[model samples]
Target: MDELKVKKSPLERAKMTLSVLALIIIAACSKVEGQADLQKRQGEETPIQVVSTIGMITDVVREVGGDEVDVNGLMGPGVDPHLYKASQGDVGKLDKADIIFYGGLHLEGKMTEIFKKLERQKRTIAVSKNINPKLLRSGKDAGGSEYDPHIWFNVKHWVSATETIRDTLSEYDPEHAEKYRQNADHYIRQLNELNAEVKERIKEIPESGRVLVTAHDAFGYFGDAYGIKVMGLQGISTASEYGSKDVSKLRDYLVENKIKAVFVESSIPTKSMEAVIAGAAEKGHTVKIGGELYSDSLGEPGSDADTYVKMVRHNVNTIVEALK
Candidate 1:
């Protein structure tokens, strides 16, 4: 025999039906929230891992990439890129980087092979590669003709490099393209202003007195941009050796021109320029060491010439004060 089922009141049935609908609504909301959370996690992106060969390039990357990238420089203050060789730690950094930037045109001569190898695996860019060939200065090294890699000396040329950095970063990370462009525009404007200011400050020196002499020919672009005559005891690359003849030639130029000052480079030794100074004194010309100029690298952190802009300003002030 089967037991009889009890009949429910109409209000009770309505309440039970409402409870079932509420349970369904609650479950659906939880599912939607879970999906929303998953999407939020997926939408978050990590900063781009960037490795640069020089301090200047690292600074540009930092400026343009902003918080979107993390930049590491292989060379630091007072390090010479022409003579710098990548170490095991640098290799590890490059391997881990999502992108790599280097001053091309054989600036990092010793690291060329390493960069070439890494290019096959990731995006490796030479900031100077896209620059106009006519804008570049050509010179002869021991290996014959080569373009000078010291393009950063010219504010305008470095502006071009900054644009290249912005474009490269934008192309690689399109999501942040607008930010990169904005940052680059701001930086380029500052560079242009810097260029104009440099031109004006250079005029403080008498035309005849506007001469720059250094241990290496790294300031060709600087001299060209600022309308000053430049002479160096050594060739473009610091790797080049200078003999007594080179020193004699440079010393005679200083003496004959009646140039009052010669500058030493931050990345190079002062002994070489000191020798030239002594040689000039022996010739009855009193040439003094103007000051140290930031050549291949920026100054140490918190120094006057630590950043690219400050470095240029410091160099110009030193030159004008000593030569003018």
Candidate 2:
């Protein structure tokens, strides 16, 4: 007969579990310390550390900072900032950044609290804040925000933001101020050309076809800048919810105005817009998805709309081709 095995007491089992958790915690602490040490060593030799919230800011930082700065974009292609929140990893990135840039005016809705906290101690700047108040469109109806945050839609406004980025980077890293200025000058020229090109391309569409409709009200500045009438099912922020009433309103508008095409934003879902499309069809109106617009974010790397200029051009071309 085998001896009966004695089970450990609950207390003994609990102690063992505690011991295991302690060891795990210690290991994690050690790993984090090791990573910090490595980062510290690397930082001694690296360029200015920059963290930007959106791809548009990231692109501008990289272009202006050039080889003088290391820029990390927190939000990537198709990432909507309006609903994005900071994670533990993002906290670490923000902690390590010498400078941070974001679109202001509540564009980063969920991250506003974190940004407000960081503003107390860090060089967290809002690029959109550089825009003139007279130029900003109001989004008061959409969650009571004072102004629209989608300044990038207007090429001229974006150009102003680029200068702001340049000035900020230059102020922080004066050693590379000349380089930044040169880069900014060159980029500004490119942006000017892009603006000209966009105007020319948009001219391809007749005045009757210049109405722009989309899932959200992101294209207000674009429409204002380029002579188009814009409508949206939802408000400025994607965080805003659209209901049956909104959908019905847009459906009726589409049918009444004979707007043939609506665009889907890369960073926003197409579900709502799809419903609008179906609703219009049911009402005996034909509306198609003109193309994917780079509204809140840029396209992925190696794509045609990866860069800011490319993105603006792509959007302009799409709008023109669809509406023409």
Candidate 3:
């Protein structure tokens, strides 16, 4: 009896040790709350919850917020922002978000109304509003609410918005203020380089060929930044269908101005532009489909043009090469 009761076999002890190790591994993998401990085991902590209305805004948020934000873009590649409808899942995501970011001044159409309502209840922001309204190039006069919403087509403008985003985050979480500021500065430098590169690239096009025609009115901001005159088959939003009057007016402009190209949008159907091209041809002027532009959504994830900077660069390069 004093001999410690016949000890377990060596194989049995080994099995017990293996079982305990398996349990530990399983626990580590499931550690949603024990984030730090899980990180020690090769998983990182999801430190923050950020919900953005679109893909481009996610890029900026992640750039500025760094590891502090777990960002989600509700609208992905090829989503039409003007006609976007948020799903139940998206609503849940927005509701749970610590901070919600949206491209504003009605880029999201009626979704902007919902975001405006949410501002009364929780944390949310319109990233585009950070740009000075004075800098905006509106299709209409800017006495009040008619300014363009796509300021991000201009890198300098986007950098300003990034600063606003950082400042907003700093206000919310002062402890990580410096981190957000530093991250914003890093991204801003990239945007600045992109701006210069865009200007130089556009110079490659012949001076007389700078006309830009597109399916949506998104490029007023870009045209203003780069000195191109833009006209859209549709209004400032995809929500507005092209009327016969709109098409007829565009045909007259194309023929009168001798504009040689019209571009299609990545997210929109080409039927409208086809009608424009056909109508313009009837007017004794033919237009080609210039490159497809990333107007509403960015490119699919791993491409050179997926990030906002690269997206803008790709667009500028395509526009320059085509127009040139």
List, residue by residue over 42-152, the lDDT tens digit for candidate 3.
654456788998788988999999888889899989998878888889889889888898988888877888898899878888887667677876645322137777778
Candidate 2 structure quality by residue, lDDT tens digits, 30-134? 999999999997777668899999899999999899988999999999999898988999999999899989898999996877888899888999998778799
| Candidate 1: residue pairs that collide | none
Worst 10 residues of 1 by lDDT: 137-146
Residue range with the least summed lDDT across 10 consecutive positions in model 2: 141-150
Assess each prediction's global lDDT (C-alpha) against the native: 0.90, 0.91, 0.83
The RMSD of every model to the true structure, in order and in angstroms, is 11.8, 8.6, 9.9
TM-score of candidate 1 relative to the true fold: 0.86
lDDT of 1 at 20: 100
| Pairs with steric clashes in candidate 2 | none
TM-score of each: 0.86, 0.86, 0.82
**Candidate 1 segments exceeding 4 Å error:** 1-43, 141-145
Q: Model 3: runs farther than 4 Å from truth?
A: 1-46, 139-145
Clashing pairs in 3: none
Error of 1 at 66 (Å): 0.5
C-alpha positional error of residue 134 in candidate 3 after TM-score superposition, expressed in Å: 1.9
Ranking 1 against 3 by TM-score, winner:
1
